[model samples]
Target: MTTLVTDTGHPVITAWSAVSPYGIGRDAYAAGLRERRGTVTGLGPEHGTTPDGVGCVVPGFGVREVLGKKGTRSMDRVTGLAVTAVGALLDDAERNRAVGTGEGAAFTLGTTTGSAQSMMDFTRDSLTGEQPFFVDPARFPNTVMNCAAGQSAIWYQLKGPNATIAGGRAAGLHALNYARRLLGSGRARTVLCGAAEEFSPARAWLEHRCLDGTDSADSAEGAVPPLGEGCAMLLVEPRAPEDAGQPVLAEILAVELGVVLDGADPRPALVTCLRSALHRAGATPADVAAVARSGAPGRAGGAETEAVHEVLGTAGPADLTPAPLIGDTGAAAAAFQAAALLAFAADRPQQAAGRIGVITSVDRTGSVGCALLRLR
Candidate 1:
């Protein structure tokens, strides 16, 4: 397992925001979680004939509508989600002050692919158009996987390092680990780290086909969970002495990542990640107050549950499963899982204060990871 933090002081997450299925912004998401509201809604004509005919999409969200039409004509759903989420994070006066735009601020985004629908649509247009070169130039940027990350940096004027990592459902953890390193290396004073995914007919059918082919009981009838779309971002910076007066949402103790080769049981790999993260954080299983499970459907879900049990015991920590309320959020799964941790802490401060919360993820793509956080 790779430990994300060492001698360097652990980075602190000061503020976070989300444009999720519950709706836009942090407050909406927190309220939805508190009410245990379900976000799944029937698929419209735009999504074609999905296997489930339903999805957990950001209600009434549109790129041009949410973000003004200025420079938004070519923006795709994923990019719009990411940009909106970053805007929400910076909207807070306190967070905005700490993360003022310039060379000192950076942006890192996690995604499976920038927007599968955009790429497919662009490709289809090229093939069906009168000529291959007749495609619209405005839409070409959406074909690349780094468009969202780059666009976010441009939109927010974040002049430091801008990168994108594609790690399926575990991408959020990967982005957080990257942000920690950036701070430790003094590459940026503040880093906006997060992940985004969009709901579309292309993604829905692709996921359905992949799950339908997997040899898991949950996929026996191709009854995979509905796809969900959204973005979640966190403001991460060094826990420096000058910021003593600022309230820290959580201290990121350790982020451990690992991989399991195909045909091997992922449970052992995830167990190792969880154990390593706790050890590096100088904490034990008994100190864990809650767990944010990935809640991935099918074989991966069962493996993740067993792995948590192996490390933290079957009844050790309270489970925070975001999938039930948000559906399958793909690349944004782990980010939403982190949000769930903070949301839980906010609702029950007395019970959550001074406790450790764990977030675990196991993706069918063979990625396994866990993060340990000291809730404050």
Candidate 2:
């Protein structure tokens, strides 16, 4: 059954900000996506020159300019990405004084893993240092995955519940669910939520080791998208007729999450999540105007796309794989897809009005998540 929501229970996105391979800010993101440009590149000798050195990274992202040199000294790349995006979101929201930074406001985010580079560096220091105490004390905080979420709250003066979830590709959906729950339950009126991943030496090695790190996972059928890093954040709050802070990018009609049993095929789980999310949102596949699919190479991607086509038929050229433009963004992939879709809806109001779309995130481990959104 779909989770029932009231006028105040429905979550609507008021503002969004993104730091992608395209650069900082949603304009850069939309331009990159619209132009079909990707930032994936081969690693240079500094990062270990190997044939497998291909991935997407945010270009010219400087924490010194954004957060200043002193405050960013202890921050890791992933945290830096998150904080930058949050600052941008607040900046946009402040244009109308929409930033409600009190206990009624919350901060939540998802990540593939903590700061990969930080964990690697600190662990190396401990293992090879003259003593355990030789490790840099300031570097310890970034080792926790929650650092980004916590830092956003601290940096932005957001005094509310802060949460961080780790779900790889599915983390964005998880953060959405958590934010929605908080809004529906009256725990927080407005929630800033999103996901982020960092492109670093450690992450690059992990990508190569997986063997599925190619820019395209299915070159035989279509282009293999690049793996990317960056952060995307959205401001969500319960909805009402008078709640017109920012023309809502979209409404979170329904959200569903499912998991495949260990060793079981994920196809069925993916299908169930899609159907369930649509049903809960009071939408049929026919009502879905677009879809953004997130999965690895092979059947994972095929399964999600095929299931949507089977249930809803064709959304035509609007069906998109963001990997080509932004790369596989790990935890941030689903959120990025939603941001892309939001940009799409905003640009093509005639096409998006009265139509709904769905964003699906299927993790390699088994979790399948879907969010049904209607443009407003």
Candidate 3:
């Protein structure tokens, strides 16, 4: 693999933070990964439609602790999670000068829906009300799919380009793809890219049904686990020769995408995507020290595993699954997997730094992609 650090256009993750099941910052999440412990909690029928399930939930998170009273009054869980994660990321990156006044800051996020709860509630209120006039105008904005990204921009005064993607499990990389294009064209100096998902009854029920519908005999019976919630944000900045001395978290070599048409095999698409990503990074499967990734259980899951093994030799210890530990994070899955790789490199530098890593994902809707990254 090519090992030079400077004179390349690769974007490096300068700073990152999260409000995950582990806690309010990346430290807690890192600790959880190191201990091989997942922070998911059991959710019985009382919590949602599932007879039995689990979820990676943040227990007793006080909003006032992160955002003042003014910020908590009119927020939904998705917005709260996004705002909280962005606040921590800005604080950690100390990008106030560049991002605070809407100077050169760009923001992008991924989400399935703005907030399932917000949309369902708003729609229900409209239909159940005596008339359309009875709907709450104040709550209308929360139903927009771009609410989180727009809210984050407004909260931080980021005036640069702000966008949101409707990517499912591929959301994180979708944001990365957009950020790369924006930055590559000199549209922005830096971009905060990530994805968020909030656990809700509507989301939980939908996921249960989706898992139940997966008829690919490869699944572990009908025992669909649980879902996870939270946001993962990364401060992606352009790499420069002079900034090489700074502590570089990870340099993104490339972001690759693939699609498997309906009623077709996904293994071919996945293999082609992985091969292209490695080739672009001037590396091969052997150069990838570890793969921080996971996939859906049935056919998608089986395809992902077979592709990795067929291309990378073996699925051995080098393969890591953050899902079993964190449950299924849906839109936030890719971001968390990327974070897991960075966390391993940071917390165990001696073993992980200077090594190439990749985060591969295969969403339910035939969307598949991987981000090639190297920790400095």
Candidate 4:
């Protein structure tokens, strides 16, 4: 296992995150964390207003700004979020590199709905209006699963292996694991790894099918996920103690992924995944300082996670449903959790040693993934 540290003398988290409901930056995120405030609120009709009052929307930067004017015309909303996030991560690395160049940067992106909006838009247009022959061919490329990863590499001039994975909620954690493996196998000098999800009207509709949308339901009491949107990126390197912009927040100790069939509880596989990750990291449940759970502020996911904690007997130190504040950013959920854990460690460095922050994700397809992280 490797213990990564940032340049600021904290454990090496290297390059980390940026997330918000209102285009707020890292400082704002820190403030929200400190205040325990929820970023979710009702977006007015100026944007895409929903019948339901709650939403997590990005405040600033539109598609045109995130992707260039020409690029924006061809990209979907989710692609826009991914490009912006990956750009921020690469920029962070460029500004803080103590040793190597950015040419060797690798990328692994995760997402559940890569271009659902695009598909929905095209379908609606076809049914409502005359057939349009002038459809832009460039836009078609962005509809594929790997489009975000490909676009990010093209934008940043990265020449390393590019990968995309999606197994519902496990997507982000799985992507991180892929990047970690690349570094460990000496395949790349550095990696840009993360996930991004875009909120769509369809998502809310899907939730209605699985959950009851009522005022009385606590955020966690809803039957389905409270879908939201955001992006998070991490820069991983093989070497430790590089002169990066920030101190090390934590190291990537271990990662594990497991598959369970539909209707299976997944608790067993999840527990095994966690135990395997801890064992690989040479740690135990007691070594974990906090658990950054990918709970969606809904009952099914939360109950399953709670059951896992019960089995492990380690629920007290973990933070439950932190995503309710920012909303569930699809593929970015686990990556966001990873970033949050690192930031939390950085703020409380004295208490971070030997304390591993565990990130867990369970996909609707019954796949489970766990990542074990610790400060150096």
Candidate 5:
């Protein structure tokens, strides 16, 4: 069997990603990277009733405008974001003919809270016996963990093997790995790979309950790990050089997953994961130019990432917590980081030549995943 990196059949990232943060897009994201602009802002209540306190709020591009009225109503805000991002990806691909009818395209969506807000809302309405809240049965399909991927495929009219993986924060990278496998195995011609996470009171409550109150701070300011919202999509194809109009972002050098026990020190596991990813990519620590990390700002998560950096001797070029601008986007965090890496490579100095970009993530379950993206 050929190594994941050397398969030559390796999938290339073509048209990918439209991030929504304070009205940001590829251009704004690129500008932010070029100018080092930090867009992290405070978040108000989910319904916009509460005063703005703290957190990264997505600006620009409402879901209805992209997905249309019917599509928007069928999805929660998080899924709506995912659909919009994927829509952007497909639109780019369609313009270049990289995607077409019967092109055998697939989708892999990663997410943590799949319609949790919808469920919560439905539950509240049912508790009050308010006519069962008039939930559309058609939307029931989107209530599950894999709903994002399924909806993406339906929305884009892609027909191929599709799956969804939820490894918490690592879910996004895991989805990339899955897409790579499908392309490498000749299972599909093109794959739309992406991840999405929607912020919900239930999720925030749970995270707060899990985190040490001391480290927990409002998300608006430059707090280490602020809650974030958004979705990102990447179009992956088996061909290395296709006629796709969008610029080739980066080549997927290698991806690996490592699981640590519930109470074990994550440092060792993370180190092992990073080392394996680099080895598989035939790269060394020195070969990496930057590290795009989860940077959740959780005490353990932050400490564990720092320990990994110390092991690799990669001191500070790391893009820890893009949340200072994008906030923590749950499963989309890593994918967003991946998008950031693409943006970074698109404009960074050539001094980064021969240097690969590494994306790493750790979930609450103690699973760590790392992907090595080589700038081509």
Candidate 6:
């Protein structure tokens, strides 16, 4: 198994922020997790057609309202979520200083696609417009998959390398791995890495159709959870003596990403990733205090559970699955999984410090990834 590790020492996550179903910002997410609150709300006509009548949307989130109306006339839900999350991370006084703007700071975002809704909408407009090529010019930019990454850099003035990674449910892990590379290569001093997913009529219908054709456990019974939308950002920087007095959330020990082709069972591949990440991190199963699983539905979910249990045992580590509370977040799943680990560790610093928190993701698209984070 190939391990994605950096020789530049373990990069630390000093700060993070989220615009999630729980609410906006870091405190709101922590509070919601502590309160065990559910964020699913009924979808009204404004949401257009949806597979289910409900979804976990960021409450009261609007592009124009959150970002102001000046340059957001064409912003879509996914871009709005990404920008809002970056803003939330910068809101922290300490994190803001750590992530100085201009050529030193980089921005990386993960997504299955930039905005499914925007792409579908633009295509529909082109096909049904007065002429074959007649469509809204302002909405064209939203159709590309890298729009969010570019917009984030432009909005925040992050002049370093900008990137967008796509890996379905494993996208966030992919982004994190890329960020580690950037830091190790001395390409950038700081990287804002995270993933964003949006809920929309187009996305909902697309997922419903895809799931309907699958033989997955929940989809077979038509009992899958509602879709969720949000973005989560982490301020990642290489370890330095200047960060001695600063707060450290978690240290990225290792990351491993792999794939299983030809419709084979996913368990073995995930097992390899888990074992590889732990080995690279110089940790044993006993050192893992908790695991944040992707909580994917159907065969993917079952395979993930079995792989983790096979490696760590069923009762060895605390299971932290965010899907039940946040719904299916698509590409943002693994990021929220990491956030859940951070939140769980925040309340148990004594037991968590120096312990490993493992994050595993298995997506139906044949992607499998695991990340080992040493809690701080």
List pairs with backbone clashes in candidate 6.
Answer: none
Point out the higher-scoring one by TM-score: 1 or 4. Answer: 1
Summing lDDT over every window of 10 consecutive residues in candidate 5, give the lowest-scoring window: 1-10
Residue runs of model 4 more than 4 Å from their true location after superposition? 1-12, 22-24, 46-53, 66-70, 93-102, 127-129, 132-134, 210-225, 241-247, 297-299, 311-320
- lDDT tens digits, residue span 73-167, model 3: 66778888898888887776454334433666889998888798889989899899999679988788889999888888889888778999978
- Candidate 1, residue 31: CA error in Å? 0.9
Give the winner by lDDT: 1 or 4: 1
**Alpha carbon lDDT of each predicted model:** 0.87, 0.78, 0.78, 0.68, 0.69, 0.86
- Structural RMSD, model 1: 3.4
lDDT of 6 at 157: 93
lDDT per residue for candidate 1 within 237-338, as digits (tens), equals 788656556668899999999998965778999999998898899999899988998888777787888899889998868788788889889999999999
Please write out the lDDT profile of model 4 over residues 275-356, one tens digit for every residue: 7887888887778777777774344475457645864575445573457677766667887788778767767776666588
Question: Which of candidates 2 and 3 reaches a greater TM-score?
Answer: 2
Tell me the TM-score of model 2. Answer: 0.92
Error of 6 at 248 (Å): 1.6
Each candidate's clash count: 0, 4, 0, 13, 10, 0
Error of 4 at 157 (Å): 1.2
Q: Number of clashing pairs, model 2?
A: 4
Clashes of 1: 0
Q: What are the per-residue Cα lDDT tens digits for candidate 2 across 1-376?
A: 2232333557888888899988899888888877887687775664544335776777766667667987888888889999999877777746422554765678889887778888989999998999977999999998988999898888877876789988888899999999988777667757899999987778766766655544245454234455688999998877766644446778898888888767365667777887877778787776777788884555566666676676677645377568656777888988898898888887788888768878887766677888888985
Q: What TM-score does each of the candidates earn? A: 0.95, 0.92, 0.91, 0.85, 0.87, 0.95
